[model samples]
Target: MEFMEVIRKRRSIRKFKPEPVPDELIMELLEAARLAPSGTNLQPWRFIIIKSEEKRRELLGHTVNFVVTAPVVIACCVDLNTYKQHKPQRIKELTRAGAFSGVDLNFNDGDKYWKQRGALNANEIREYVSINCAVAVQQLVLRATDLGLGTCWVMMFDQDSVKKILGLGADIDVLALIPVGYADQDPAPRPRLPVRELLIKELK
Candidate 1:
């Protein structure tokens, strides 16, 4: 399918058919997410594919009931440890590859730079992880649309409880829950603000 068509057709599918999503297609969706861009190429995303009825039932308390209707529920998580461990290595790699060409890369002052800090503070880590994880999830959603599958990016959930249910470690945090399958209903296009209202300013 064409890119724009996929974008137009993609919906937050709450209802799904009984047919299961093929394992190969599921992998393709994950592949798209795996290749998403991240800050400093830290690539902190980790996915837990929940398919069993029993496991989905466990997540029901933390998430919406509609999530379990889909054949697959992917628990998207961010590894704080990965971000902490990989920044320096990724920076060095980029420096070697001229990614920061003609730019001064400094680590002399720990106070002034995030790279120099031993680790990001809790809020900083959450914000950074959220942005990167959202990108990956978006890619997964778009790819699912292209494959004639359906998906929903579910964020209205009890994050801490869901994390515990998924058996995530201290270094890992659940970012979003995505339910995927074949759609049972065709939803109308949602309302969008006009372009004029969206544009804040245009500098000459």
Candidate 2:
């Protein structure tokens, strides 16, 4: 499918059919996410694919019961260490890969970075992980849509409860719970703000 069409066709589907999504297709979806770009190419995201009926029931407990009806649920996560704990290593690797163009040290990891890190109290780590993981999540979502699958990126849930349910450690955090499967219903697209209103004029 065309890229723009895929983006336009993608929707947040809440209801899904009982049919099961093939394991291969699921793997392909993850592959798309794996190819997403990340800060210093650290690739700090991990995923949990929930497909078993019993586990799905457990997941339903974390969010609204209705969403778990999908054949699969992916727990998108980010490793906190991807930034704070491994900044130097990632920067070194990025330089080797010719990705860390010094345009960013003086562009990669410089005195200003360490100073900002000290000032931010490590919050910069969250910022990096969040952006990287979000990019990956969107990649997965778009790939799933391209495969004729429906997905709902769920965020409004008890994060702590979900962590406990999945036995996740503090080192990782869930960004979204994407329920993927065949759409049970296809409603009209929701309203969107006008492009002119959303796009602002460039500053001279």
Candidate 3:
């Protein structure tokens, strides 16, 4: 499928068929996520593919809105250790290098930034790492759409429950849960803000 077509046609699929998704296609979707760009190319994302019915049911119980009818649920995780724990020195270097050029790094009189930097606990860093994982998640969703598969991005779940469900180490953080499979219903396009309302153009 064409890129634009995939983007336009992609919808948040809530209903799915019971048909099984092949391992090769799942790998392809993972590959798309693997290739997504990351801050400093850190690539901190990890995916846990859940296919067992019991585990899927348990996951659904945690996030009732999650589309577990799909054959697969991919739990996206972010590894905080992957990027040296977001130190102030590194942030200074990144700022000096213009790594965040055209972006604002300030956060509430700098307290928010320092608070994030000082995050030594898993919960604190989990929020930080989840931001990076979101980029990879977008890639996965788009690639799944291109592959003629449907997907739903689920976030309303008990984090601890998910951690226990996947038996993930305390160091790893779950960012998002995505269920992928063949669609059972064709959903209409969701409305979006008009470009005129959403975009602000500055003509020089």
Candidate 4:
């Protein structure tokens, strides 16, 4: 599908057929996410592919019960440690690649331009990591749609409980739940704000 057609056809699929999505296709979706751009290549996104009925049932306790009906529910996660561990090296790498041309690389004074990840509070750090992870999630969903799979981003869940259910450590945080499978319904496009209303300002 053309990119715009994929965007237009994409819907928040709630109902899913019993047909299983192939593992090869799932890998393609993951590859799309892997190629998503990240902040200074921090690449904090990690995923838990929940394919078993038992685990889906367990997650249904926290997320919408309908989510369990799908054959796969991906637990999209953000590894906070990625930023903490790779910040310096990524900055150096970016410097070498001329991402910040004409700027001197500094090991002291926290590099002045690069904000210190360590300075962020617990909530700030999570939000920071989640933003990067969301980019990857969007790419994955778009890829899934192009491959004739259905998906819904489920966020109205008990994050702490879901985290425990997935056996993720403190450094990893579940950002969203994506249930992927064959579509059981062809949903109408949800309402969207007009482009005029969406733009704060338009310059010639």
Candidate 5:
């Protein structure tokens, strides 16, 4: 499918068919995520493919809607350690490579921003990493749509329960949950803000 067409037709599918999604298709979706652009190419994302019935059930129990019936659930995680200590090195390398030629790459006190978002210390870094992981999730959604698959991004869940269920590493934080399968119903597009209302152009 064309890229624009995929973007236009993609919907948040709530109901899914019972048939299972193939492993190859799942890998294709993951490959799409792998190709996503990350800050400094850190690529801190990790995906946990949940296909086992028991695990799926546990996940469903934690989430309120839109995941139990889907054949595949991909849990997106971010490793805080991926960027914790590499900022200085990354800045130096980018500067040497001319990647920061037109940009202000200096972030002397990066933690200051995170602190404002309620990220206190090292533990909060994991939460900050999860925000990056969400970018990969968006890529997965778009790619899945291109593949003629239905997907729903679910987040209304017990994060701690999900982390325990998935047995993720201490430094890993769950960013988003995606359920993929064939759609049972064609949902109408939800209302969106008009471009004129959303965009602000500053004329100098």
Candidate 6:
């Protein structure tokens, strides 16, 4: 599908058919995410894909009915271990690459902006960590749309339970739950702000 058409047609699909998403197509979607940009190239997204019937059923209430019904559910996660492991290298890279051609990069910009919360707590760091995963999630959904699959980005799940269910270690955090499958209903386009209203200013 054309890029714009794919973007326009993508919806937060809730109801899904019973067919499973093909592995080949799933890899293609993940490939889109693998190419997403990240701060200091610190790609921290970790995907935990759930396809087993028992697992999905177990996640039903913790997540939503969609998890039980959709053929696939992906747990989008952020790896604190990866961040810690690569921190030194990423700081060097970010500082060396800099913000732009002229602007110097303060690699510790994260420190400055976030440290005000007293000792740079996990909550503050979570904001930056989630960006990498969020970008990947966007890519996954767009690719899913192009493949004629439907997806819903879910965040209302019990986070701790999801972590336990996935057997994730302390180094990982659940960022989102995406249920993917064939759409059962054709939802109408949602309302949106007009182009002019959305734009702050348009360059000539």
- Each candidate structure's TM-score, on Cα atoms with residue i matched to residue i, is 0.92, 0.89, 0.80, 0.93, 0.85, 0.85
> lDDT of each prediction vs. the true structure?
0.87, 0.84, 0.81, 0.88, 0.81, 0.82
Tens digits of per-residue lDDT for model 6, 75-149: 889997666677667756665765323423433464433234344357656777797789988998999999999
Better of 2 and 5 by lDDT: 2
In model 1, the Cα lDDT at residue 40 comes to 81
Ranking by TM-score: 4, 1, 2, 6, 5, 3
Where is the poorest 10-residue window by lDDT in model 4? Answer: 102-111
Candidate of highest lDDT: 4
User: lDDT of candidate 4?
Assistant: 0.88
Worst 10 residues of 3 by lDDT: 103-112
lDDT of 4 at 192: 96
lDDT of 4 by residue, 68-107 (tens): 9999998899998987798889978877776776534543
Query: Compared with the true structure, what per-residue lDDT tens digits does model 2 show for residues 89-188?
Result: 7666666776534655454545445556563445677777888999999999999989999998898879898988878999889888999999998978
Flag the better candidate by TM-score, 2 or 4. Answer: 4
Residue ranges of candidate 3 with Cα displaced over 4 Å: 85-127, 201-203
- Against the true structure, candidate 6 has what lDDT? 0.82
Q: What is the Cα-based TM-score of model 6?
A: 0.85
Lowest-lDDT window of 10 residues in candidate 1? 103-112
In model 5, pairs of residues that clash are none
Flag regions of model 6 displaced more than 4 Å.
94-119, 200-204
Q: Give the higher-lDDT candidate: 2 or 4.
A: 4
Residue 109 in candidate 3, Cα distance off native in Å:
24
Against the hidden true structure, what lDDT does model 3 obtain? 0.81
Ranking by lDDT: 4, 1, 2, 6, 3, 5
Q: Which of the numbered candidates is closest to the native, going by highest TM-score?
A: 4
**Poorly placed runs, candidate 1 (over 4 Å):** 104-119
